[model samples]
Target chain A: MTDRKKTTIVLLSGDYDKVMAAYIIANGAAAYDHEVTIFHTFWGLNALRKDENIQVEKGFLEKMFAKMMPRGVDKMGISKMNFAGIGPKLIKSVMKKHNALPLPQLIEMAQEQDVKLIACTMTMDLLGLQKEELLDNIEYAGVAAYLAEAEDGNVNLFI
Target chain B: MTDRKKTTIVLLSGDYDKVMAAYIIANGAAAYDHEVTIFHTFWGLNALRKDENIQVEKGFLEKMFAKMMPRGVDKMGISKMNFAGIGPKLIKSVMKKHNALPLPQLIEMAQEQDVKLIACTMTMDLLGLQKEELLDNIEYAGVAAYLAEAEDGNVNLFI
Candidate 1:
């Protein structure tokens, strides 16, 4: 392994605010020259999903889940003060007013910075999300791979 | 300062399930001889509240927050399948059937294992929680103190 400091994040929440926080920290760590990985698991995988619908075969539960869950970061709700989904819109408007980058832009910045974005394969299976539905170029991994990186990490966080 | 591995968890969600997961990880790390810390912040501060109400002065907002938040771990709602307050009770019943320890006992186990439990001073202030309203023997700290522990932590988590 290289001697560079490592930062690994396990993004477990689907909330827009939580995902933004994870990406912000990941981007910050990357800017600081730390090797960073964001292992997206469970609902966190929603952030990696492509916005456009992809016609992929799925089981009944999977299809139901796919229909219920948000397609991408832009559709996600905040953890608190969601107020029947208006909270995210309000926050986005506030963000624009303050010139802060939105979640999608933050994610793009992470990719531009070469931050490793990994979708947990096990959860993808459980959630019935296929690779075709996720953003391109991101990695697919399991908890073992996550532990391998986090065990040696200087900053390991589960967001 | 010691050679022991470190595991630091920032408990940001007050949900019963989330708090249980955080405590489980902390207890597990402590069992493995890792120096462990659980920094309870934001809604997480609710987990440290005493079951009985205390006579503490508070502003209108703080009082409103206190009234809105759960009294302690037992009163906290589950992150999912809450069903308007049935989830925690259901989970507790299931835990009993499975012989899994409940959150309060899990917290006790962590204390018994010498795992440090810290209440985030900043969030406590923002949430209007008082020292008298929390459990005895827990430390109060801020983000800087959390970072000091987590910077060198082998397994750092924000739950």
Candidate 2:
């Protein structure tokens, strides 16, 4: 059998820094030719939000969730020092100065690198997020799917 | 060579849930006979604080850090839904109901299980955290020490 490694990350936190770390690791591992899969769930779904609103019908709670949550990676708040949303902007400028890609660009890069992006269907249902709300070209799956991929994986992380 | 594995966790976030997560993973990995080392730094040092004040001489910034930061894990505020510090208390009560160990207890259990606890010396210098401010029977090290342990670690987590 060929010697290959698989890296699976369960991106559970929606925080800006954590999501950035997840993508960075995923892309870095993929660059090493490791088979990579990122399972985004719960708050992590916010990372996949489209910038423009999609006119999808939802219940009151779901509507509230969608409206209250940040629209996309560019709008995400820092977990700390988020003084009325200014911290994220400051970090964005710092990222720019360091020539680090923004979260959107990082996500795009991970996708381009053939890193599998799977959204937890259960989380989407619970959060009232429709497929139209997320970015295109991503697959939807459940925990069983993730477990199958991670069972013999050399590296598994829960972010 | 033995089949034993090493797991190194970098505790960077001082948020209540996040710190709890770090310990939970450490304890769980220890249960599976994996060697675990937790590197605590920056705000993460808040988790290592003793609830009672320790009469130790320190510089002005050190004293200020000791006074301003949370005294211990029990005093840490949640990263989100803090709601004026109610969220952590709520979670603590839930943990009690579920017969789950509190963060302090988890720390103790980790120590008892021989999990290595390393406080980041550079962060201590930066944050003005003196050795006396932390728990006893722990190691003090820098990133090089962590790297030495993590170089061959099958699991390396940055929390």
Candidate 3:
């Protein structure tokens, strides 16, 4: 295995389905022995939020931003046909029926598989999300960090 | 050139940003000499619509469906902060200043690079979009067709 391949995924959407797809791809790539890195930016940062409120010192706008967006994968809405937020519930039910892991579980699985998770520092600053607001064990980086990794990656995707 | 790889993308979002990412990846993959196939399903089918009205014989539902959705890539709204459809235009100006191609032009580049475009028949049926409502030179296919192609693909994405 001298020639280990790399997969870099830029998760730019915070929608449940899109985030799920990112983890699915990352997990699959990891399963095949490829190093996978997911860069979470902008709306994608929603997937990394902690479900429980972690009182972190922030400005009023940051507090409002965190309050308004979904806390975590479980709370994110579908990209379309959200239908007053029932759409995510419906999709979860379907996933359960199919014995597929929900978004939260998928993220955990990717973590267990040693997939590198990088949260975008620029987005966090813009959205006013503090480190305490996000889940643990994730790296914080800028676009240059992602581009550096993607430069040598055999597979790179922006979603 | 012997072990040429393949990339398959399942485009399921019609949002301007998402659709742009899809075409960008498709074009990048094609430029690398990989055989790329994009399966446009559900909302993704919206991206393939012709900007001009196509005279196609269809049922009332199909006519209504066509009328409701954005005509083509040029008209798609951003997934968030659309602000009554101004977000896409703002993004377009940014793209132009960056010397980046607009979504429509990106789609055209992918096509010229010989990327395979597949419209999901099941989605078309469900959405009541007739074949005539879409652009020309695209293959209409069901899930099985996509699966067959993806089976041998090295990179598979759902966006």
- Arrange candidates, best TM-score first: 2, 3, 1
lDDT of 1 by residue, A90-154 (tens): 66765664466888999999999999999999999989999999999999989999999988889
Per-residue lDDT tens digits for candidate 1, residues B53-142, read 899998765676677678899889888899988988999999999999999999999999999999987557655789999999999986
Q: Write the per-residue lDDT of candidate 3 for residues A28-96, one digit (tens) a residue.
A: 999999989999976899999999988788765456556667889888888889998899999999999
lDDT of 2 by residue, A65-98 (tens): 5666677888788778989889988999999999
lDDT of 3 by residue, B15-101 (tens): 997787678767877877778899999889999998888777778887787778888888888776567875666566555644667
Query: Least accurate stretch of 10 residues (summed lDDT) in model 3 chain A?
Result: A59-68
Candidate 2 lDDT, tens digit per residue, B38-85?
999988988888888878778988778778889899889876557788
The TM-scores that each candidate's chain B achieves against the reference are 0.98, 0.95, 0.94
How many clashes does each candidate structure show, in the order listed?
0, 0, 0
DockQ of each: 0.23, 0.09, 0.07
Off by over 4 Å in 3: A1-8, A15-34, A45-159
- Model 2 residue A98 CA deviation (Å) reads 19
Q: After superposition, how far is residue B82 of candidate 3 from its true place, in Å?
A: 2.1
